[model samples]
Target: MRFTRRKSTLWRTFESRYYVMTLLTPLGLLGLIGILVLIIIYIIRPNFQQKVVSSTYVWKLSLKYRKKRLPTSKLRDLLLIICQILVLASCAFIIAKPACIVKSTETNSETVIIIDSSASMLMSSNGKTRFERAVEAAGTKAGEVLDGGGEVTVITAGPKAEYLCEKETKENKESVLREIKGLWNDNQNDIKCTYGSDDIDGAMTLCADTVADNPKANVFIYTDATYVNGSVPEGVNVIDVKGEEESNAAIINATVTQDQNNYVFSADVIRYGTENTPLSLKASFYGVNDKSGENGKLTFELKDIPVVANETYRITFRKDVEYTDEDKLRGYKLVEESKLVLCKLVADTDVTTDEEYGVYSFEQVMFDIAESDAFDFDNHYFIYGGKKEKLKVLYVTTPIDKNGKGEENPFVPAALSIAKNYFSSRLDIEVDTVMSDKQYLLTGYNMYIFEGLKPDSMPVDGVTFLINPPKGDYKEYGFDLGLEITSKGSEGDTLSSNSSNKLLDGLKAEDITVSKATSLKNFTGSDDSPYNYESLLELNGSTVAIARNCKENQTVVMSFSTHYSNIAYGHIAVLMTNIIDYYFPATVSGTKLEVGGKIEINARGASVIARESGFTQEEFTLTEFPATLVLTRPGQYVISQTTYFGQDLTDTIYVSIPQSESALTEERYSLENPFTERDDSDYFNDLLVYLAAALVALLFVEWWLHSRESM
Candidate 1:
């Protein structure tokens, strides 16, 4: 039941609050207080009005009127109270500004920094390597999160996927920024993620898998426009950075090749864009002649390339061509490998009858083998840097006619036919056909095929066949098949009649199994010393199948030709394949490329040891070596090093370089995620808005408090 009344005063009616900065701008508080005092006395005073009231009974009503009109603190104490509220509000607002600068608790935070280290990142995009600028920009934003006490994980997006910083330990601004400064677009720098081939598809999956384990975590991906072709992970924030220039075209194709002559080389060229893209092509062929001058320069005829696109050309060389090709397209031949090349061919004519019915087929066989290779030199005459795909055959025939007449021409006709048959078949072996005639001597072949030709003149160069030569010369020309020498040689190495060659006096039951040699009837006791092979079809007096020896090379001698028996043809072909596979060997030059290559290759139990520019030499040792070896360049390779028993052998890898500019456009963009937003994006803007609102509200409160204090 309190009653009160008052006459309105200018200072009492208007309240002017004062602003005081406690620690900062303390002088500002004094100026604000002075203005408040002035406003209350001068500006507010002239407008002051008075209301009069009287008697005690009226005062009671006046008290209710006062409470209704005022509804505030004691008017007598209003000046002090207003001064206190104004000073406090100023301090409170300044402190509250920090809250506006920060964000709400996002709970667990996943900050992924996807740095672009692709080839395009090397270009100056926005004044720096797109990579360099990206790292700087990412660092600034990472600070905001770390400043807010959140954790961060830094990732790298390049040809190799990696993590520069793990999402471990409490995030520190200094440490994060420090890591950013040391960050490099190289492997030795980012060792956490082992480098693999460029496969962004897998990398995208990895990015998602990394954070998917922790649900409700926010993801921030920062990168350049290299990842245009790649997909962004789910629930990820993408902060994309784009460079100012995307117009540079670089040479992406550099490849190596192997030719028919076993020569190796590499070629690369640049393409130009017709736009204001003033470009240069500088090719330094390493591991070869260092002609740094324009002497090695090669220019192209194409011109006016489209913007961001280029017209490309090539530079090529080989080992056999002359060093001077200034006028030719294929220039500068490397040194040639000596060509003491050995060649051979097999005749289709089979001869494995107990008797000698020799018809010569050497001429026809030689002619066909040469003609078959005419289509492409690589198919037919690839030299012996290694071996080619063809069996090595040993054709042994006598120059005597079926009737034993010494007609050289007649015997040769049938001999040549035999050669054709054997050559076309699996005996598709390379052979040196020895002739008794002075006109045609054995040359250029690895194994010898004697067709009734005198074994006397045949050198020990290859396998020799003595057609039932009176076991005399056998001591020097053959292996000892019997327990002892049947006859002795005049000289230790002479293939004369006295050569040690013998047959067992008596045949044992197992000498030739009846089942294994059904054809051997009356020929059983005949001296089988001339032939020493696992018999395929043996007849009584002689064998249609046998094995022979000349030095380390094992030769099989059959007693009949296809002219003698059709049955021998089957065994002949089988033995031919086996023998050829044994002798005609193949050598491999492993995969070779410029250091950083596209397609990596490997062969069975082998490694590329030496590489001079483009030539990768892959070596393999002989284990039941085959007589032929073949290879193709720029291919998906499957190399094998298996023993004759198919046991495991050594294995090595080779890789081919990508060609220049063919698909320089094929390798698409890098890992730039435009859809992935930065964790502190428009959020920073939101903070700014809060700071602005807080500052404005602060001004009004202080002004009102000062006006009251002045009264």
Candidate 2:
């Protein structure tokens, strides 16, 4: 496209003519008027006036001579006059610097350049990333098109197709180059190169749509050709700018295991090149001292290990650093300080050798260590060195047989014991059985399990479970038990079809035989009542099980006794386990997280600080429980939290990069006319120069013709 638009209205009016000329200056018009005046005066005025009265007699004869001679001689004079007029007109036209607006039959085609800016493009070689090179190549092509009198459109293929510049001409070429330079800088610094994948196909589709109306349009794609395959659009070209391949070693996997007092760290390394290289596996441990101070760094290195090309090698390291009394005290302080048992693996090498074909190479590949629970290791583990605390559960039951033999309901306690064993590996649960008549304080327990007994007053703290309580008007405790007894046949009432509740996960009501059950009709604690209660199990419009939250305490009420129902013992055991685990979930120290993945945590009023390998730290405050956190980088992240109880919690999470991105090999795709040249230079200036020269030649010819006629 031309940079400037013609004065179209005036030019179009003169379309009937081959060429149209317009004066740029008013002086040119004045020159034309002066020439017209001279020509008129020369023709109309007499050169001389003599005594014509004396020749009156001869005047008739003179008229006869003048009439015949003037007709023949006037033709020569007219030729001279015409030549003079021609010279003047040509001079005036040249002074006006007239620009002829010639309509062309052929239209310039459009050119679209698409560049990839995905994460894979960020792989650098020779001090430049693939993205930088792609941008440069695209910019060069755009410049060529703009110079050839064609329009250019630049698109960046990122997570989405982004238009950098659209429908730009040679006049806007500088602006287009400036935008491309910005992308180059951003890619170099890895500032906004956050796109994980490329959308080249989508970008190409967009380009096709952009040029749908123009048959002569062409599309160029500049990328590493990592994601290019299959069919391409007509008139589309792909430029594969992939660089030479370099040898690289990446940590494919990592894990930690405990053996007695020793902690073992294992990692799998893979080499992607054809040459063997010497590799180093470095492990760094950040331990906490008793005073919550830095306990000095512990580094273990496996150096000069022979790593074969195109092979996977496993390396393992174990250490048994004993934890003294001071270490245990420091473990407690570590929790308060939000310090985690941090461990990191970094793969490196000392070899400075270069490959013959590679443009650039990396000497280090930091391994992302997988995170494990603090208790997964032995007691001497960094954060779990101290003696672990057990959850205290108080079980209160009334005597079922009050005839001198003081025996309590054994089914409920047996279920509780079974549930306790299920979670023994995660956390220790201590169950203390107490008779209903025994005086016991509820403050010391983490959970209270009541069997066939109603407390005088509900505990305002901790989790409580009530089973088959007698009828009572416990208005003070926000519950009024009903005295109605409902009996079912040998077959129990069918479980609600809506059994999506977590409490009824494995237990099915159809399998149970409930001979008798109490209906919770008088238990009025819901939205319509003074208390809040959520019905868990409902049969015939009556609630058989309900849950209530009073202040910070959780209470679950069941209307039937486990002894009366012939429900599977395993099902009852699982129900009991689900109830305890639901109320007081196990503390999760850390988890294995992938890059660009999200992790949800349920610790209210806690601070989450994540620290990466390069000392990059990010802090987030969760005002409520179940906050979502996204891991963006691949490395070890120490996630520390401070609970509402002034207790510090620490967890370690590892974010790993995808395997596809780790293979730093460039792929090739077929391209048509990848290196086609462009014609972008405008011809208006050259045309103007030739026009000026032609006008000068015409003026010379007019002068020569007038002189010859005068002679």
Write model 2 residue lDDT over 1-711, tens digit each, in one string: 669767687677666443644434547545677577867889798879455554676887887876777665677667656656765766666566655434332357689898886666666656566777887888788888889989998888876777888889999989988888778664323344443556676776677566654657888887766435654445777776656764456665666554542345556666566667655555544431111223333455545455566666665543323345754443211111321132222222236763111101111122332222111111011122122236788899887776525687767777788977777544568889999888988776768888777887776556788888777765655556664545555555544424466677777766655545676654454556535666677655566777764335467887787766665366678778888777655334345554566777655123455566434555555545556777665556665665433345555556665544445555646433332333222211123365467667766765665665544
Per-residue error for 252 in candidate 2, Å, reads 3.0
Q: Candidate 2's error at 459, in angstroms?
A: 3.6
Cα lDDT of model 1 by residue, 287-399, tens digit: 12222345322222222222233543333323343335432432222221321111111112236653321111111000001111101111111111111133334444445
Q: TM-score of the candidate numbered 1?
A: 0.38
- State model 2's lDDT: 0.59
**Positional deviation of 394 in candidate 2, in angstroms?**
3.8
Give the clashing residue pairs of candidate 2, or none: 1-149, 147-680, 147-681, 148-679, 148-680, 148-681, 149-680, 290-330
Runs off by more than 4 Å, candidate 1: 1-106, 116-148, 154-165, 171-197, 215-243, 246-433, 436-608, 611-711
Question: Among all windows of ten consecutive residues in candidate 1, which has the lowest summed lDDT?
Answer: 362-371
